[model samples]
Target: MNYFIFGGSGFIGTHLVNLLKEKYPDGNIYNLDIRENNHDGKSKYINCDVKQPINLNIVVDQNDIIFNFAAVHTTPGHPNHEYFETNIYGAENVTAFAEKFGIKKILFTSSIAPYGASEEMKSEETLPTPNTPYGISKLVAEKIHMIWQAKKDTERQLTIVRPGVVFGKGENGNFTRLYWGIKKHRFFYPGRKDTIKASIYVKELVNFMLYRIEMDRSDVEIYNCTYEPAFTIEEISDAMMKATDMKRTIYKIPGGVLKFAAGIIGALGGKSFGIHPDRVKKLMISTNISGKKLKESDYQFQYSFEEALKDWYNDNDNLYLE
Candidate 1:
């Protein structure tokens, strides 16, 4: 059976592709993405964009699985239309491709953004109140996938995972920024220490994905992908400090003071001064999510937050030492 991965060049996709290669070395792997492969040349790379109808003359097998991870996810980085253009249209195109090939199984990596900036711990059953364009787009994409699954309910399999901030090797996002912050001794608490930042290590994230794929469930199963009893910013920072034993003075600045400085910098056409207005605003919002269904499942959490940090830290000292 072949594996088709959309956005396989991205952070999560790259790691997922690695896992696939190790597990199914002989299986045909196809990566359809706008970017180049982030791994050694092992899989078939197709320069395809999902914003439009995909024209793949590939030898798609009946048992092949499709993983749709394509989307514009950067909140402060993307224009409003870009999210819809990539996420909404990409969903339609991917589902169409799956239908075209009669592929019955699909796993989608959605975000906890759909739950909005809520401080309350939410589960899969929680009603979504997505305020951002990115969140709205993902919520709509979920429905698009659901509609596809509904059409062939008996035969098809669909699994959806809504993960929080996923971090690990090759991830140059939030955790990377945090690493830099701590290393440079510039990391400071953003007004609130208790802000819940629900997150998971990328390796652990993919492990859960594989768990769902191997499960006997069929047709419409959605689970939030986060460590239950999420960590506060202070807690996360402390874990990092202990993991690396880095000596850095950390303190909290008044929210109003930082917000005011951010406004001036933002108005001056500056993205940020390590204090973007948008980033600062996002700092206080909590992502206290509950992976209730996952907790109730037979799958166990193999990697603790501390273990993840230590693994990531030792994986590359260059990232921290630099």
Candidate 2:
């Protein structure tokens, strides 16, 4: 089987590439990314921009499966236009390329952020009320895929995966920030420590994608790729504290106080604080998604949160200490 992956150098993409190599040892795999990956020499890497129209006919064939994982994911500092250009325009370019080459099976990696900040459990049926440009772009991209799928000649199998916060090795930004907080032994708990956060292990998410690829049904499928059991911030912090043998001081700052401070920081341009207003809002909001669909599909997680954290801690001990 020939597998073509866009954004193969990213955090989730790297893990997906590794899993594909292990699962299909003799199969041909091609990675299309802006930067070349420095991993094992098993897969072919092609540097290309998904935002621009490019002829991938040589690399992508009719029988191959195309996975679009490229996007400008949620970043507090990123401009709104960046998200639209990369997530929306990039998705359109890739889908058009796939249609032109007769590639039928395409998997799009979307986000639960499209559901917005919800207190209720989010499922596949939830109405997408995207809050940020990142979320709006992703949701819009998925809609574009649906439009292509509706065309008569475009007999494509589209699988849209709305995954929760995905964490694993090589993860930067949000995961790195939390890891550093834990490693420094100064982890602070804002509001209540028991704030729930939904997440998926990278391996599990990859497996889900592979499963969808193997079972190619005619219907357009959408699934939430997340762990069955949701986790709380307090639980994650406690596990990290136990794993590192570190005693971190926990602070229970009132939510109102934090909001007020955030407003003040926002009004002042946030340059002096080095923290964005979006980050402050995210910290207070809770995200809990239901992975019932994934579980019902007989997908099982290989590693628990504790196991993932332990591996992460051991690998980045030096970096965190510094």
Candidate 3:
């Protein structure tokens, strides 16, 4: 079967494509994205903008798997409307394309943002109380995909995955920034040391996705993707330090004080001060999500907090600025 992957050039998508290639060396995988795939450069690339209608003259069987990872997800990074514009339209267009082609098998990579900035570890059953535009848009997009599946539940296969902060090689997101912080000796704990930041390694996440899709179960499956017993901010910091063998004096600053100071610095220095107040606030909050559901499943986790960190460190030096 062929694979049509939207946003395949992105951090997670690239890893997913690579893993898929490993499993099916001869699989016809198409990477559709605005950007090019710099990770493997093996998958057939197509210029696709999910915000617009995905009406390309493409040919694939009805059973070809479609993976949707298209969205504008970074918070405090994009304008409020950008989130809705990209996410909503992307969902509409992708689902529209799927319906048109009668593609029964589809997988969507949603976000844990729908759970909002909660201190409690939320399950898949947790009633989403989304606060941010990113969160709200994603929750809505989940509905959009579900609607498509509703048209033909007995035959359609739709798997929705809400993953927390995912990190690995080529990922220039939170974990990369954290690694940069420690490397530059600017890493510091905001507020308390116990704030849980639910996260997962990219490879493990890809494996989990494949495992679930291959399962002969329900037609529509929704689950939260994260490592169980999520790591605290301090624990992550310690593990990261040990992984790269880069230890420095990291001080725990109170949340309020750090936010205030960062706000002023960010205002004066403009974008030069990457440490914005909103970012500081995020660090203080807890995203302690439970992977209890995933754990209960037959899918086994190959990486732990320490092991994931070590694997990433040894995997590449892209984020490791000397």
Candidate 4:
């Protein structure tokens, strides 16, 4: 088997690549990314930008299964245009290549961000109301995949996965920011501390993707990839504080006060605050998503939030803390 994974240099991508190599030792895996991956010789890394169309025929054959995981992702203070260009354009390019080569299966790694922040748990059936440009772009990309799948012949299959916040080694997103901040004794909780944040560990998400691909269903499917259990902001903060042995204060400022301060900081060109406005919004709002469909599909979480956090801390102990 030959597997092509875009964004293989990223946190989730690297973990997925490692898993694939171990699971299919005899198979060949090709990584397409803008930067070269630092993995061992088991996988081949190709430097390619997904935003631009590439002649994938040289690398990808009809027998190959392509996983489109490339994106600008969610970043604080990033321009909206960058997200659209990379995410939307990248999806278009990947689908174009897949259709041209008649690839049997193409798995798109999308985000739970498309469902947006909601006090109520969002399920697969919920209509998407994307709040951020990153989310909007991801939602649009999913639509593109659906459109292509509908128009394609009977040979191709498209699976769309809207995963919650994915965390693992080398991840520098909201998870890493909170983890390292707490580890370095710079932790702070904004607004209410009990907001539940939907998230999934990288290993579990990859496992689900591989499982679905093995099933080889013909219909286009969308699944919300997340853990059975959810974590509250307070719980995560407490866990990190305990793990790092930090005694730093956890402030519980009123939500309105924080929002006002954020508005002022935004007006001041984000110079007043060290963190970006988007990050602030994430901390304040609830992005909880449901994993009922994944659970109903008989997928179980391999690791608990506590276990994953411990692994993260142990692996990154020397690099960030020392």
Candidate 5:
């Protein structure tokens, strides 16, 4: 078996490569990414960009599976045009390459952003009402891959995963911010503690993707990948504190006060403290996403939020303590 993973230098991609290598050591795992795989030096890195035509300087076998993890995913980070340029065009390039190479399977890591920010918990079957540029682009990308799957018919297998905030070691996003702030004893919420942070550990999310490919029967199985009964800010705080064995002070500023502060910061064009109007609004909003489809498939999660926190603490105890 051979694996051709696009954007394989990313956080999820890196971990996925590690998982594949460990699971199938005999399988030839090729990372077709513009950047080299920093996490695994043993990985066979093929220099290719998904925005352009992929030319790995080598031929891809028909049975080789492709995993597309490349995209401009960070919201309020990239220009609106960048998302469409990278994500949509990237999808086009990937599917075209797959068609040309006769690759039979494609696994894509899309985001829960397509469902947009919702107060109620959303399932995989929920109507996608994407509001942001990132969200819209991802939805379109999924469609592009689906079109390929439809054209290939029964011969193709397409697994699309819409994961909520995925976090672990080396991922310097929302969760990392929380970890560092909490470690520094400066972690606090801008509003109520009940706001949901629908998330998954990086290892488990990757595990589920591999499992879905092997177990699910559908030609195309789209799953909303995240922990069920999503962890709220309070729960997350409690887990982190317990895991670290630290009794750090957690303050909750009033929403109105936070908005006022964000207004001033926004006027000044400052986003240094991980605070801004948009971020403040995001903190207040609840994204209660469900992974009922995976659960219904009899998939078991290896780690809960608490267990994941402890595992993370164990891995990075020195960094967290220092």
Candidate 6:
């Protein structure tokens, strides 16, 4: 089967491409992104923007599957409008391309952000209350896919995966920062100990998606993807530190302290000390999403937080400890 991946240069996309190569050695996989594929050599790279009209020149078979991962998802980085423009427009263009090419299957990676930052555990049945532009835009993108599926009602297969804070080898954001802080033995609990930090190992996430696609289930299936038995911030830090064989002092600074500092910075027009008020606020809440649908599926997750940490810590490339 042919596989076409939009936003194939990003972290998840890169890993998915590798998985595709391993699973379908003879299949032709195309990676379409605004930027060129910088690492993986298995998949062919095509310079195409998902926000623009799809180019007809890129060959695709009707039996091929298209996975859409393009989005502007850096919560605090881009302006609000950028999220809607990239995510919504990108989904539209990709779905249009699929329709025009007679492709019947689409797999999308949406975010748990749609549920917003809540302390309660959310499931697929939960109604979305997306407050931020990134969250709102992702929910809209999911709707766009559903509309396309509805148009093709009986013929199309759509799998919408709402993944939580995916982390692994190429991830250099949140997980990496935490790793560094722990490595230096200065990591502290930023908020309450019970704050849930739902997440998935990138490899496991890609594996589960492939498992679903290979099953060739008809119609639409939506899943909230995260590792089972969500871990608290305290638990995560402990597991990561233990897995890495790091003996560090875990300190807890009351949530109020961070909030107060954030307030002072906001009032004085001073720059945030790597901790914005919004981020500090989020640290106190739990994004405990339920993966009931995925858990019920036939595929078993291969990596837990401990296993994922072991993989990364052992990989010299990933551990950039001085």
Decide which is better by TM-score, 5 or 6: 5
Model 6, position 311, has a per-residue lDDT of 78
| Reference-based TM-score, model 3 | 0.95
Screening candidate 6 with a backbone cut-off below 3 angstroms (N, C-alpha, C), the clashing residue pairs are none
What TM-score do all the candidates reach, one by one? 0.95, 0.88, 0.95, 0.88, 0.93, 0.93
lDDT of 6: 0.83
Query: How well does candidate 3 match the true structure, expressed as C-alpha RMSD?
Result: 1.9
Q: Candidate 2 residues 1-322, lDDT tens each?
A: 7888888888888888888889898888888889898357867888879889867546557778888999988667688999999988888998888778877888999888899886788889889898889999999999988877767433668899998778767776565666676665434566777677888767678887898887756558889887767778887667767766667767777766766776787788864443455665676677888888877876666677777666666666723411
Q: Write the per-residue lDDT of candidate 4 for residues 1-322, one digit (tens) a residue.
A: 7888888888878888888989998888888999898477767888889999967546557778888999997566579899999999999998888888778788999988888777888988999998889999999999888877888546668889988778777776777777666655544677688888878877788888888887756778899887655678887778666655566667787766666776777788964234555567778887688877887786666777777766666777734421
Per-residue alpha-carbon lDDT of candidate 6 for residues 121-181, written as tens digits (9 for 90 to 100): 8999999999899999999999999999999778889999999878887786667767776
- Residues 1-322, candidate 1, lDDT per residue (tens digit)? 8888999888888888888889988977788999978478767889989998988887887678999999899878988999999999999999999999898889999999999887788989999999999999999999999999999998888998999889888887777777777776756777888998889989888888887776655679998888877888888888987888876778898877878877897888864335477877787788889966787888888789999888888877724611
Residue 33 in candidate 1, Cα distance off native in Å: 0.6
Compose the digit string of candidate 5's lDDT tens values, residues 1-322: 7788888888888789889989988888888787887455647887887899876677669877888998888767889999999999999999999999898889998988999887988998899999999999999999999999999677889999988888887687888777767776645687799999888988898898788766434398789888877889888878877877878878998887888887897788765565666777888898899977776777788898788777766768644621
Q: Rate the local accuracy (lDDT) of all candidates.
A: 0.85, 0.77, 0.85, 0.79, 0.83, 0.83
Tally clashes: model 4.
Answer: 0
Candidate 1 off by > 4 Å: 265-274, 318-322
Once fitted onto the true fold, the runs of candidate 3 whose alpha carbons sit more than 4 angstroms away are: 38-40, 270-273, 317-322
lDDT of 6 at 36: 94
Residue-wise C-alpha lDDT for candidate 3, range 119-169, written one tens digit per residue = 877999899999999999999999999999999988888899988789888
> After superposing candidate 4, which stretches have Cα over 4 Å from the reference?
57-59, 242-249, 256-274, 317-322
